[model samples]
Target: MNITIERAALLRSLGHVQSVVERRNTIPILSNVLLRAGDGELSLAATDMDLEIVETVPATVGRPGGTTAPAHTLFDIVRKLPDGSQVELDIGGDGTILTLRSGRSQFKLSCLPVEDFPQLSSGELKHNFSVAAADLRGLIDRTRFAISTEETRYYLNGIYLHAAKSKMGSLETPVLRAVATDGHRLARVEMPLPDGADAIPGVIIPRKTVTEIRKLVDEAADRIELSLSDNKIRFGFDSVVVTSKLIDGTFPDYERVIPVGNDKVMEVDAKLFAAAVDRVATISTEKSRAVKLSLVRGALTLSATSPESGSATEELEVNYAESPLEIGFNSRYLLDITQQIEGEGAQFTLADAASPTIIRDVADSTALYVLMPMRV
Candidate 1:
């Protein structure tokens, strides 16, 4: 196979496909990316079995054929090449080596059989929908931070995406909910259910897939196409196609964990509260990372203490108190939920010091977080 392509277009697609290939692979073919040139276009594909990404770009195809080459090596070489250079990729006479040439520089890299690369089969997706790239991006940004990295409970490791009844706030009807949790903290964002998306299956999108799709959607033009089946989800936009295997476990019913009838509501300046938590958490025990919230009559006090590092306390005027409450939570979790706020204040509802707390932004009612309390 031989092809000539612009560095920008090649790099853009390579950047998307290469990430799906891991730095280490037990199988030889898994380490290489399949390059297929045909009909005035170049297609790049990479996979680690669980996830696969394919990106296609326009190119001048001198010959129509396919080959497999190291994704990272090719990426590194092209990245270091002269600025704005067009690259020539041609098959060696033996068909076992790939020659890369550009501006007086030439390199021969080992190649593998394209047939050895495993292709993820496309299923007859039951649901097909499109969402604005910006909206999709917001949903990911607001919830991805809470995905669990633990391997034991594997089920909690990815974002739990499904259709849920919008319990409270403006969009009171049923909406699509994106939720993630690591036991200690949780992030949940809701959006108006898309047309024809009401029957989409609920699935846990793996962490890597979430990250890869997020980057794709961010760079994609206009809207992103989403297709879902029983065990797979696909995203395609701007020449890129991503397919991920959905985790095959039921997500715990999240609503039971979200407390209701929490009469004590407090509204405080989000920035001020977050900064205070940051300051106090510095001295808190690293293992615990606990910050205590003391709300009494219209004022809220944020504090954290460590036996070795002393204590910190900062006060902020709040819109609180049907009852006085003291609750302890992970400072990092508090900051994460609060930082997503776009406006001045964060509204938190409490049942007591031990029960879960519901946090919402005053300016936006579409997103909420449920944080478990800690013992201080």
Candidate 2:
């Protein structure tokens, strides 16, 4: 195979595809990327068995052929080349050596047979739909922080996506929702259901897949194409395509954890509240990172104490007309949820100090967060 591609274009495509390849692979072919050049374009593909990313970029093809080469090595080589340099890739007649030439630099990389590389077949994705990139980004960014990192509860290690009916006044509207929880905190975000997603089944997208797709969304066009089945999900963004296997476990009934009886309500400026919490948390114990929120009818006090760090306290005036309440929460968790709130104010609904508390953005009704209380 022989092809010439711009360094920037090749570098960009390589950056996208090489991330899927693991640093260590039990199978030799899995460490390489399958490169096929033909029809004035070059295709780069990499897979880690469970997740796969394939991208096509325009190239000047000299002879149509294909081979497999080390993904990371090639990426590093191209990244170091001078900007705007033309990269020429040539595979030898014996098919064992692949040569790369850019400017005055030349390198030879070992190649594997294309037939040896495995393919993650996205077989007959029955459910298909399209979503705005902004919507998709919002769904992932807001919920992914809550995805569990524990391997034992594998089901909670991904975002559960499904079609549900949301109550708007007295009417029900179909919406696509994404939910993630780690038993400590939960995030639920939704948007109006797309036209073709009405019958789509609930699927848990693994944390890794969520991360990879989120990166692609930044460079993606206005819309992204989604195709999925019971066990697989595929995303298409212009010339790039990503396919991943769905998690094979069932997510918990998240609705059951969301507090419905939290009557005590308080509204506080999110930025101000976050800053106060940050300052008070400086004296919190490193292990617990606990901060106490002491709320009265019109004011809230944030305090933290530790044997090593002594104690700290800060006060913020809030719009709270409910009865007095004291609650303890992990300071890191508070910062995480508050960062997601785009609005100036955040509403906190509390049932008691021991029970879960619900928080929502005053400016955006589509996102909700439930944080489990921690003992101070």
Candidate 3:
């Protein structure tokens, strides 16, 4: 196999594909990336059994063939090469060694047979659709923070993506939604259903896949192609493709956890509220990370107390008209949800100190958050 490619182009594609290869692999082939030189282009692919990323970049192919080499080693070499330099990759008759040359620097890397690499067959992806890059980013950013890290309840480890009927006034409107929860806080965000997605299966995208896809979305085109089945999902950008296995467990019925009877309403500037929480949380216990919100007719007080770290309190005028109430929550969780609010104000609906609280953005109706209260 032989190929001559621009250093920058090779580096970019390598960066995308190498991240899928795990740092430590039980199988030797899994540590290598497959590089194939074809008609005027080079394709790079890497996988860690469950997640695979393939990217194609234009190159000057001297000979059409393929080889597999250490993903991280090749990426580092290309990254260190001079800017605008041309990279030449050549494999001899034996095919056990790959020679890389850029300018005056040269290195030889051990190669593995391309035939040994495993492929994750996408199978027949019956459901296919395209979503705008902005919409896709919104769906991931607004809900990914709530994805659980616990391994025991593996189902909640990724975003639950599906089509649902959202109530619009007196009508039911079809929408695509992403929901994530960790038994402490829940985030549910939705957008108008994309074409050909109404029948898409309810799939749990693993957290690792979400992280990898989100990183590439910024570099992707204006629209991204999505294909899925019951157990697999794929996202295709212009020059990149990511295919991943769906989590096998069942996600709990999250709708039952969203409180419907919370009537005590309060509206506060999200920025101000977040700042108050941050300042007060400085005195909170490290184990609990708790901050108490004391709400009254027209004001809210954010306070935190720790027997060893001391105590702190901050007051802010709010739009609450309901009865007085006090609720405790994890300060980190509170800041995470408030940071997602794009608008100036965040509205909170409360039933009491013990029941769950519902929070929403005043200007955006498509996103909702539910937080379970803690004992102060």
Q: Please give the lDDT score at residue 227 for candidate 3.
A: 97
lDDT of candidate model 2 versus the reference: 0.95
lDDT of 2 by residue, 1-376 (tens): 9999999999999999999899999899999999999999999999999999999999999999999999999999999999989999999789999999988899999999999989895478999999999999999999999999999999999999999999889999999999999999999999999989999989999999999999899999999999988899999999999999999988889999998899999999999999999999999988999999999989999999999979999989999998889999999999999999999999999999999999999999999999999888
Model 3, 49-136: lDDT tens digits are 8999999999999999999999999999999999999999999889999999988999999999999999985577899999999999
Cα RMSD of all models vs. native, in order, equals 1.5, 0.7, 0.7
- Among residues 3 or more apart in sequence or in different chains, the pairs in candidate 1 whose N, CA or C atoms overlap within 3 Å are none
TM-scores of all candidate predictions against the true structure: 0.97, 0.99, 0.99
Which window of ten consecutive residues has the lowest lDDT sum in model 3?
117-126
Candidate 3 Cα misplacement greater than 4 A, ranges: none
Number of colliding residue pairs in each model: 0, 0, 0
Score residue 139 of candidate 3 by CA lDDT: 97
- What candidate 1 gets wrong by more than 4 Å, as runs, is 167-172
Candidate 1: count of backbone clashes, pairs at least 3 residues apart or interchain: 0
Each model's lDDT comes to 0.88, 0.95, 0.95
